[model samples]
Structures are given as structure tokens and as C-alpha cells.
Target chain A: MKNLFISAALVVSALSVSSCKKDDKDTTPTETTGTVELNMAHRWGMGADNFLLNMELVHPMTQDTMTFTTFKYYVSNIKFKKADGSWYVHPESYFLVDLATAGSEILSIPNVPTGEYTDMEYTMGVDSLRNVSGAQSGALAVANNMFWSWNSGYIMVKAEGTSPNSGSGSFAFHLGGFMGSNNVVTVKTVNFAGNSLTVTGGHTSEVHMTVNPAKLWHSSASLATTSSLMMPGATAKTMATDFYGGIAFDHIHE
Target chain B: MVVSLLITSTNNNHSPLFDRGDFFQNMRTILFIVAISAFLFSCKKAEIENYKEWGFEKPSHFPEPHYKFENNTQTYDRFDLGRELFYDPILSLDSTISCAKCHAQTHGFADHNVNFSLGVNNTVGKRNSPALSNLAWYPNFMWDGGINHIETFSFAPITNPLEMHETMTNVVAKLNASAHYKEKFKKAYGSETVTDQKLLKALAQFMAMMISAESKYDNYVLGKTTFTSAEENGLQLFKTHCASCHTEPLTSSFGFANNGLDSDFTNDLGRGLVTQDPNDNGKFRIPSLRNVALTYPYMHDGRFFTLNQVLDHYSNGIVQSSTLATSLGTGFNFTTQEKQDLITFLNTLTDQNYLANPFLSEKKK
Candidate 1:
């Protein structure tokens, strides 16, 4: 009888151990999160199609006769708001958009927590404080030739090269200053037309945005009269306003 | 708890004792496991190092740094890279000049016995090579306050026809060709392709680490050392006369004001060129007083070779201009004894440790 009792106890203990092992094996795989890719196409005026970098013609907008030698600007603080009113901010958000390069078109927004989004927002230029402050890294790296060494500030929008339209042999206008009246940093917002984007597990979304370079001349003076702007002044302010006004939301694909 | 568990188990082994002793032992084991797991998790925490890194060593009494570690974080590798580039002649177009060629460490990082630095092809630069120290605290760079960001600072000297005379694109190509530079760039920027961005960042890492706030003046302020009677008197006089523009702590407000140097205003309208404002004509940024005793041939033109000449400029040579600093409305009248005392105080601003510090000097390859 004692042996029978010992055997029954052992069976009970064995069952308990088996149940513990079963609990440890509950590895139901969670769904893998996906990412959204932002494809930005820089455009210019109504008929203008291409962006000119160092006098090289590249079709980006549709058709434009603008020949540029230097074109560089900073885009930062990208955030997308969901229909549920939650925000997905891209961490360490900084990007130097140069029209001269093709590979730079794909602005990667990574490690976004899985969620649904409805709208997007971004800044046209670097914040004012960063321009005044000294030294920076990554997208704001001064070595990219986007910064002015003589006058302290990021050349927020550098458009230079020779143009017959311009009376002078060449032109260089580096418009940027984040302080007082000269602050050119512009924030842009685009609504997704009320369509909810499903950023769920195993999903990918692509958003297309359009930027116009001819907007730089919208309210500003003609290139014939004014050709040079290396510092912040009335000319820079006018040029920056016209350029920022040309930015528009293109479309979203999921 | 173990003993109690043993006693309880000794009394009743078959029926699985559920007493306080067993409960306590189980709780203790769980807590220990949790503690160890927490420690391991913290150890596994990953860090994403940025492209640039280097910082000033904070002393006990120093104020919050002016050039706060912004995007540039502090790291030992980046600092070493910057130190190497600082002493390397490869930055020059002809391999004949390096940063150390002009800013020698023995002279408090100021050029010794030369008014203007001789560049490639023996071309003379416009400005003197200023003493380079306590840079992490400086808000602006160059006498004209022309260069804004520290990362972009090297571009001026590197591309200046009278300096290194190397183009940024060409410099990147040259560095990319070198295997050693490729490895260094890979370590710092995670890439073998040497770009202008990485080159400037590495140079910044070196320049930003040049802090020189440990002079006798700094020591006196920190309460570590007491100044002599003459030094104290000189300090008081400096506060009354020179402290308005040449502020304390950093010893310069990083402003552009005409200090009565070039009254005729032929071409050197210091701050006026940047602003294009007539009021800023003939104005220049105030320089830091650190190592003022050694960085002779003073002023932007390097015309004054002695401290007394600089004092005389401040004393009887007050030039009237719209952009002249209000603090220098009237020239300072210092007696011979007072001049000597002021010079003595200025001598205390020289950081001997900075001049002789091996960390800032050329690192033996």
C-alpha cells in the first residue's frame, strides 16, 4: 500500500511538471511591423518640370528652364497624425535634400511603431536656434557646404549658377536666418484627404509630396535686377517667402 | 528561512509544506532573479553614437558650457581622430602645413614669433593665428565672428588661398584615397567613403575639445588659488574698464564692436561686411583674453606686438566711430604701476597646463 501511495504522488508531480513545460512553450509569434516610404518630387512653376543643379537639367516637376549650380536645404521634424489622434514622430529627424543627387530621393523614415496615420507635417528649413548656435552633426553637418562660414547661419536655400536671365556672370543666393524678421523656417502640413492609412503589421505605405522651385520667384523680384544674396536682407526674405509658398501635397499610396 | 524549511520538510516531506519558511525562500529567490535580470537588461541597453563626438572636461566651479554638446556627443574615438587630424599635414594641399604649423601647442596653440601665418606657396594670411584654447566655451570664432558653427569653422582656413589652399571636394577625394583615413572615417562615420561632412566633423571633434579654463584666473574664481595683491587690483580695474565688452568667464562676449583700431576705415569694416549696416562699420568681435601674454602681435592686423601697445590702444587711442563700443567711449588712463599690475593680471590668464598638455599636443603615432 505504501508503494502504491508513492507511485500516485509521483504521477501527480509528473503531471504538474508537464503543465509547467506547456506554459513555457506559449510562443505565439506576434506579427512583424512594417514601414512607410516617403517619395518626394521637387517641382517648379506651372510649366516648369525639372530642377537645375549646377546647370544640369533633371526632370522633377515637369518642365522648367532653371539652371542651378547649388541647391541644398534642410527638412526636419517629420510627424504623422493618426485618425485616432496619436502622433508618430520620426526620431532624430533630419534630412538634407539636394536636388543634384538621385539616391537622396528616398528619405527613409524607420522604426515607426505600428499604427494607422491620416496626415503628415514637416519643416521647410532648419529651426532658427540651430542657425544661431554653433556646430552640428548629421543632416545639419556644415561640411555639406550648406552653411555659410563668413556669416554665421545655415544657407537654408542655396541656388547658384550662371543664368542669361541674370545680367551678372553668375548668381549665388543663400537665404537663411532663424531670428526676428529674417526667420525663414516654414512648417508645412498635408491632410491625407480623410483616408485612414493602415500601418498595421505586414503593411507598407508610400506617400508622395511635391515641391515647386519656381515659387522662389512668385513674390520676389526678378533675377535680372537682383542676382546676389549671400546674407539675410530684404532680398532673402522675399525669396524665401515665394519659395516656401510653392510646396504642395501630392498623393498617398498604401 | 532555509533552516525553517528544512525543519518543516523534515517533519513533513510528502505533503509539500506551505509554511512561512517556504514562502520566504521562494520570495527571496524570485527577488534575486529579478535583480540579476534587471542588471543584465541594463547591460544590454544599446546606444546609437552620432557622427560627431567630443567635449570639454567640466571642472568643479565652471558654469554650464556655452557651446553645449549639441549634436556632437563625447567619445574617446572621435577625440583621438580629431587629435590626429589636427597634427597631420595631410589637410594641407602640399603636405607642407598642418593646424600645428601655425597654432603650435608650445605657444599656447598660438603662432610663435610670426605676425601672420605663412600659407602654401608662402602666401601670407590676412589675420594672425589666434591662440586656440578654451574653444568649447567660445560662442563665436575668428576675430570677425565670421564662422558660425564649429564644424564649419575649418572650411575657412582649409579653403583660404592664403592658408591650406585645398578645396573641400578635393580634400575629400584625397582623404578617401588614403587607407588610414578610410579606416578612421569608417570608425567615426561607419563608412569608408570620406565625405566633406565627416572631415569637418572630425576636425570639430578636435577643436571643441580644446578647453583652457584652468588658468590662475580660473583657479582664483574656483576658490582653489588666491591671487596676489596686484592681480586682485588688476582684476578690479579690468572689471571697471574692460569687462563690458571683454566679459568675464569666457573673457569675451563674442561681439563685434569697434575697439578704436582702424579709424580711417579703408577696407576692414569688421562686422559691417556681414551685416551691411553702416553702424557696424569698423567693428570687430572681441577676442578672448586667455593666453593674451603669449599671443602677441595683437589686434586683427597683428600690428601691436606687446601688451603695453594694446593697453596704449585702449588708453589714449580711442577712435570715434558710430560702431565704437560704448564701454570704450573714453580711453583708459593707466599709470605705469597700474599698467604693470594689469599686465601681471593678464599674465595669470595664460594657462600653462594647456600649452604643455600632451592630450592637445601631437599624439605620437
Candidate 2:
């Protein structure tokens, strides 16, 4: 028991040291630059309930009983606007926001020169360039299973779940199209509601966003009518537009 | 992980190397030994593996390749790993079919005497497996040119239910599970973890080395050999009739064309499905005709089994369509003698060296 206590104390010390290292990383920002984190707080429809996976929920619009098994989407090409009309573009800004994967909602934007940022610009789906750039790593890796093999394009947004109201007893919607008239990739700008986020050195500022997953069916039919949409077309574009449009910048916690 | 060990050894920690003092010193010695052995093991492995030094060389006759092996730099080991992966059936869901099942080495890396190659469970595919050669020169892949990257080409077939019937995740998992594959991947990519990107890049490396440039026609172009009268006549005929689409040297411009295949394209929209343009209906990529004699069963659908049938289609069997190649007006009026001469010219394009390249063949267990 005494040895066990000692070992436990060692583990606790190690954990605390590791956590302190992370705290240092976040707090002790470089003199010239600071980190800005975009926290995507996922929510349901008009009721504003927490949107989570593997939990039974009723669709606000479709009135269909649904349980999402997987909900993954791509958010990329982050850009921040300065007070002087100049924008700081993040290079290689790509992220796969998976509901099942913890902490994926936080998009960390690093190496921003300390300044007053007026607006946040980000892409809802992967950029057209990355979709055509072939095999990628990190969030865009093929292992993520977010790419269409035969047709050659990334699945911009995917929502797989089970629903009792569906004709097939399951729902799978993969929305993506990066080329031509049917392209579903949208570049959305969040102007912080006319407010400015002041970023100073040795600090981390956050832009909290509200992403409504239920907005996909805001303008579409119920699960019984259309349970699955696996490819790109008019239906995918509509669903993507609805979902992407629902994502709004609520406020900034500086 | 290996990187950390390397950094530790290269650091200022040498007192324990020559000491047998305590557990800490012993731990340091073990780490040093492990790092040294790892370095020596890799060196020994490389020394034992008798592979030709790899550098993607575009043939002097051919123009600069479209994919000049950027992003996917090739070494001999990477090519070797790719060759193994290509021949291994592990890419298939059931381990019953491999890329080599459809793309045989002897048949210019196309299916062997079959229009549609069998996949897992003997399920057949729709389109013919096009011969893979000089792929480093191809800017786009597949019949419809939907795939634009060489690194991502294998994903199409590996995941196609009518082909390998495997998911990229499962394939990577299976590769990661196997000790042989893990070691191969480690030797090739510096990590035991097998990823889709690494797998695809390795395959691309092997493809970059598949240079088919030593044919009789290539010799003729180089002024090393003189073509027969029939070959010369056939070359002239090909230039006049087919050069606009199936351009010279590479024998393809890599553009899409309807080619008068059909009037109605409801079954297969071809390039139209990718672009969503009605004008591109029934249009397929203009395939390279390198080793045309060996790569029989021509066209995207493998409708023609022989060069004669292909020639016949060009001569008389032109199915008129709104999206048909405007260059291919009605049909050509080639006689039997001219067809024979064209066949001779195509036969001269069969590079014997490319077919029997020992480096590309499967490594025996």
C-alpha cells in the first residue's frame, strides 16, 4: 500500500507536469504573436440543444427520430481580417471536425501577429485546390474515409446515422463537390457582429461559433422521403448550403 | 520513435556508454545499442537488397512527363515496396484479387485476354483495365479522366466494388497487421505505420519507373533503325487519321473524346458525370497506344478484341453521335492491305524490354 501510494504520487506528479507544460504553451505566447482558437459549439435546431453523436434525438423540422452514429465534416482555409482591411491567411489551414473525436471542435490558429482582428473568414468545406491535390495527410488523410475513391473528390461533409422514419432504417448523407456549377464549398465570413477581438502577446483569444447540425433538413424532405444522398448533385448542394449557412459567429471570448 | 532514440544518442550522453555502473547507465547503454543496431540493420538491409539505383528518366524521344514524380520522390526501395503491394492480394477485401490479377505484366499491365477482369468473388467490372505504361506522363487517369493525380489512382480500383472491393481503411489496417508489410513499409517510408498516402505514393514510385520507350518505332524515331515500306505507309496513315487525338511519341494527347462509340449514353455518361456538361457525354480519355499490339482489347469498354476490329471500327463502324469526335468524320476507307500495314506499325510499338522488366516483376517469397 505504501509503494502503491508512492507510485500514485509519481503518476500524479507526471500528469501535473505534463499539464503544466501544456498550460505554459497556452499562456506563455511569444512576444510578437498570439494564438486564436475558434471553438465550434455544435448545437441542434431552433431549440439550441447540444448536438451529439450516438444519442437519440428528434429532428426539429423533419420530425424524424434519429441517432447519429458518425458526424464528420471538413473546415478549412481560415483567414482573419485586420482593422486596416488586410487579411492574415493561415497557410495549410485544414481541419476535420469529427463529433466522436474529442476536442476536434477547437480550431487553433497560431502565429498571428498581435493585433485587433475585426473579422474571421473560413471555408465550410475543403477548398477546391485540396480536393484535387491528391493524397493528403493530417485531417485530409484518406484513412479518415472522407474521400470518394471512384469519382475522385473529398467528401466535404458526412452524416451517418440510424432513423426509424427512414425507408431503409438508416441515413447516410455525404455532401461534396468542388468543381463546376455543383460545387458545395462555401467561404463564410464572420464579422464578429461589429465587435473587434483584441489579441495581445502571452494570451489566447477564442471565437465561439454555433454550428447547427439539424439545419441540414431545414429545407429538405424528411428521412422517409430521402434517407440517403451519397453523391454530389442538387440535393447535396441544398443540404450543404443549409447546414453551412446555419454556422454563425456568436461572440468572442478574449 | 526512432527519431527520438537517434536524437538521444547524438546528444551529450556518453558517460554511460563506457560504464557498467547503475540501472540508469545500463538503460543508456541499451538505448545506444538499440540505436546503433537500428542504424546498422538499415544499412545491412540496404546492402543486401540488390536493387538498381532509381531515378525517373524520361526517354529522350518522349516529351517531358506530366507527373515528373513531384511530391512522390522515388527510391529503389520505394519502387520495390510498390511492386510488392501491386502483386499482393491484400489490397482486396477477400485477399482473392490483386492489381496484378487484372493488370498482368506480360499483357503490358492490362487484363489477360479478358474484356472485364474478375474481382473478389468472381464479380466482373464494367470497363476494361487500361494498360499502365509511361504513367509518369499522364496528367489524368481513368477512362473518364475523373482522377487527376497519380498518387490517388490506386484508390479508385482498390475501393471499386467490382474491382478490389476493399476500403482504403481496411487495406491500411491489413497492411499494418502484417509483419512483412509493416517491415516493408518501414524500410520504404521510415515508419511501420501503413497509411493510404504512403501506399499510394509507393505505387506512384513504381509507376514512375515503368518507362516503355525501347520499341522498334522508338528506334526508328531515334534513327537507329529503318522502318519497312508498310510501316512507313502505316505511320503516314496514322499521322493523317489518328494523330490529332492519339498524338505521336506518347501515342495520346490525354484529352477526352466520344470517338463515335454510341449515340445514347444513359448507361455510362463517361466524362459528363465528372464535369456535369452535356457536351462531354460519352467522352473518354484518349489512351496512350504504347505497346498497342500487346495491350489488346482496345478502347475504354474493351469492345474491340483485336487491332483489326479497332481498325474496322475506325474504317466502317463509326457510330455517329452529337458528341462524337469532330475530327473523325464519318469513317476512313482503309483497305485490308492498309489495315495489315497499320497492324505492322502498331506491332513495332511493342517494347519487349518493358514487358519483361525483372525489376517490376513480383519478388518471390
Candidate 3:
């Protein structure tokens, strides 16, 4: 009877130890960290065509044949929302996405806490505070040629291309505004549908987003009518809004 | 909690009767003490650093400066570098025109009595170069208040086709190529990389220190000296007529106003071009009266050659415009005596100490 009691106690202790180990294993992954990369895919036309710099492409709406030489825009204030309603804000989150550079499309946000993120939010332009604040580094640097020297504001979107339809044989649209009625800063948020983004330890998760350049001329006139815009105005407002609205989250690779 | 848990688990085999709760409580107390000490140490360090750094000198009588130096911390090395860059002609496209070429120190930092200052390759600018003093007090920069920050103000002349006419990228490249500039940059900033931020901030550090608070007017206001009877009378008249727009102490109200400079806005829209509102047509930033005597050829287009002309414009030369300030009803009906008194009072604003401060002048390499 004593021997039987000893065996039962050993079995109970073993069960308890095994259960504790399982609990430890379950909790360890919650402390893991990983990086999340935002891949912005740019396309030229409404049909989701490849956006190659210096490649000739015809706009579906304007029907103007154009070859883009330079296309760059500011993307900033990136934030990720976890499943538990907490947010992870990327520090100094500013990027100048230029079409000329191949790797510029991928914005790798490192040191993100491991968790299942439900939504991602980002701004289409540099914030007004940074615009008013003097001098900035990284992507918002003046060397990027995305800053307006005269007006003291960022050129949030720049699209320069050569078109046969244009009067000057080229078109340049520099869109930006920070304050008052003509402000063009746009904030966009996208949910991952029902698919939760699982970020594992030392793993890289990618969120792919599609950007349509043709949407810039969605509500505006053809390049033939108005080719050059060096300042912010009503036409810039319409074009920037259309382009910002067209950006959508496509998929996430966890 | 994790440390305590690990300790308890590690000792579980050695001691079966170990008091896990007591161990955890003791560990928590120790951690609390350590964290408190660390926080206190950091706070003390921060306070010492703040006191050690050179801060903005705020006179008791003056209002708080508009620029708080939020990002750019003021330092002696940074200011020295900025002074060198301000006097360097390498910032220009042709390396012939420095900022000092237009904004000379002797002429109250305004161009040398020129209505329109010339830029690189003898390119003439549209408007007069304003005096660069007490810029830290300015809410916005330029005649139209287009440039919001003082750091960004340099970008206008540097890139303007009629000014320095140099791209920021090209300027950076040139600075990078120079071994001397690289060494200066290394001394100012920790690294040798001459970025736009470093360049602008260093310039801002030098410009922010261009305070002109030692004028005769400032002395009189501070009870260090007394104003003459004519000057005192002019001050009273100025209060009644001009003080609303050109506020006292700092001299100008930094707000946009159309002082009836023109009836038509076709030539230059002034503030209208920036705001894009037709109502703001012909409106320009109120010119500061500090060192007004030295900074001649005033107004946005430098149409007025002297203080007398400016006074004449206010007294009689105010053209009818829709955006004209309501204060300038017809004109200030100033007699010759009143004009002379106002001019005498205005002369007291010239800070001779600031102009010849030697600190603001070009360093003799």
C-alpha cells in the first residue's frame, strides 16, 4: 500500500512538471520580435501594368502615350494595430519612394513586437508639423529634391514624364500642401480582412500594397491640357486626392 | 517577476521548503530601489546638460522668442561653423556671391543701400534684401511670410534663379568635395557628413544669436537711459498712429497687411501669392522698425528709399486698395515737425553695438 502511494505521488509530480513546461513553451513566443516590411507596388495604368521608369505606357483615361522619367512621393507616419487594440508606431517613419530606385519600394520596419496585427495605417505625405519644423534628415532631406525651396514645404508627390501629347514634350506635376484649405495630406488605413498577420521570432513579414499612378489623372485633364504644375493649387488637390484614394492593400505574407 | 521566478525554480531542487513569495518580495524591493536611483540619476544628468548648454538670452522686457530651438541645440562650435558658411561664397552657383554680399553687416545686414540686390552672375532679385537682426523673434520669414521657419529661409536665396541659383544637392556635393569644409563640419557636428539638416541648423544657430536688444530705445525702455523730449513726443504719436501695426518693443507686428503700397496687384501679388486668396492681395509683412534708419530702400519692392519716404507713404502716399489696412484711413496727417520727431525716434532703434559686435562679422581665417 505504501509503495502504491509513492508511485501515485511520483506520477502526479511528473504530470505537474510536464504541464509547467507546456505553459512555459506557450508563453515564450509572446516575447519574440520580428521585422515587418511594407512593399509598395507601383503601376502605370488602370489595368495594373508594370511601372518601369522611362518605359512608354498609354493612359487608359487620358489615352496619352507617356514615358515617366522621375516619380517620387513621401510616405510617412506608419503605424500597425495589434489584435488586442494596441498600436505600434514606427519611430521617424518617413520614406521617399522614388520609382528610379528599384529597392526604394520596399520599406523595412524593424524591431516590431511579435504579435498578430490586424490593420496598418500610414500617411501619403509628410505631416504638417515636420513641414513647419526646420530642416529634416533621412527621406525628408532637401537633397532628395522633394522639398520646395521657396515655399518651405515638402513636394509630397512628384511625377515628371515625357509625353508626345504635351505641348512642351514633357510634364511635371509637383503636388504638396500642408495648411489651410489647399492641404493635400491623406491618411489611409487597411484591414487584413480575416487573415491576421502572424509575426514570429527573427522572422520577416511583408505587407504588399498596390499604387496606381494613372489615378493621378482620374478627375483631372490630360497632360496635353495641363502639363506643368510647380506649385500647389486646385488641380494639385484633385490629382493628389485621386492618387491617394487609389492606393489599396493587396496581401500580406507572414 | 521573471528574475524571482527563475531564482525560485533554480532553488527548487536544493531546498524543498523555500519561501518563493518572500524571495520575490525582497527582489521586488531591490529592483524598485535600483529603478528609482537610475531615474533620479538620469534626471540630474539632463538638468546639468541643460544648464551647461548655451541657451537663448531672453531679456526681461522682451517677449518670448518664436523659435524655441526645438531640434537644433545651440552650441558655440555650431554657431562658429554657421558664421563661416554665412560668409562663404561657395554656397552660390558661381562662388562670387555670399549672403554677406547682399546682407552686409554695416548696412544693418540689409544690402548696401541698393534697391534690388544682385545675385550670382549679376542676376537682380525682385525685392529688397531685408535686415537680418532679431530673427529669433520673427514668427515667419520673408516679406510675404512664405518661409515659415528661419532655417528654411536660406533655401529661398540659395535656389532662386535670381539669387544664389544653386541646387541644394550641388551645394552639398561641393561642400563634401572640400577637405576644409569636411573638417569644419566634423567639428560642428559629430560626423563629417554635411547634410542639409546640419547645414541649416548650424546656420540657424548663428542667425538665432543675432539679437539686437542693446539699442538706445531698449536702454531707454529698461530705465538705463532717458529719451529726449522730441523722441518722447514721437513715441506718443507713434503709439496713437503706428503702434497698432508696428507694435512697440519689437517694432513690427509680423502680421501681413496692405499699407496701400499699390492699388493694382498685377506686378506682385505679395501675400496673395502665398495664401492664394484674392482678399490678401497687395498685403506684405509689416517691416520691423528696429535699425530702420540703416536699412533704407525699404518696403517689399524697396520702393521707398528712406524713412521719410516710408512716412510720406503712410502720411499721404497711401494708394486706395481693397486690402488696405483700415488703420490707414486716409493718411496719418503728420506735419514736418512730427515727421522729424518720428525719424529721430526711429534713429534710436539702430543698435550700433549689434552692427559692430565683431562676433557677427566674418571670422578672419
Q: Report the poorest 10 consecutive residues by lDDT, candidate 2 chain A.
A: A25-34
Per-residue accuracy of model 2 over A1-254 as CA lDDT, tens digit each: 99999999999999999999998886653577778999999998889997899889899888999999999999999988899999999988999999999999999988887999888889999888887776888889877889987677889999999999998999999999987766999999888646898788867999999999999999999999999988788899999999999999888988
DockQ of 2: 0.51
* Rank by TM-score (best first): 3, 2, 1
The digit string of per-residue lDDT tens for model 2 on B1-365 reads: 66567557645555435455655665776687777788877875764354443367667889988886667666777888998989999999999898888888898998857788888888988888999899888888899888888888888889889988999889999998999999999999899999999999999888777888999999999999999999999999899899899888989999999998789999889999777789999999899888888787888888889999999999988999999998888889799999999988989889998899777778788
Cα lDDT tens digits for candidate 3, A1-254:
99999999999999999999999887775556799889999977767989888999999999999899999998999999998899999999999999898899999898898989999899999989999999889998887889887777999999999999999999999999988767899999989879878787778999999999999999899988999998778888889999999999988998
The digit string of per-residue lDDT tens for model 3 on B1-365 reads: 55456556545533443368756765665576567667767776864465345357887778999987888877777888889999998899999889899888887899857889998879889988998888999988988888989888888888898999998888889999999989989998988988878988888888888878889999999999999999998888888999899887988888989998889998989888888889988999898888889888898888889888889988998899789999998998799999999998888999998899676899898
Give each model a TM-score. 0.75, 0.82, 0.85
User: lDDT tens string, model 1, B293-348?
Assistant: 98877887788899998888788888877667777877888888888889999999
Grade the docking of candidate 3: medium
Alpha carbon RMSD to native, model 1? 14.5
Clashing pairs in 3: none
The 0-to-1 C-alpha lDDT of every candidate, in the order given, reads 0.76, 0.87, 0.87
Candidates arranged by DockQ, highest first: 3, 2, 1
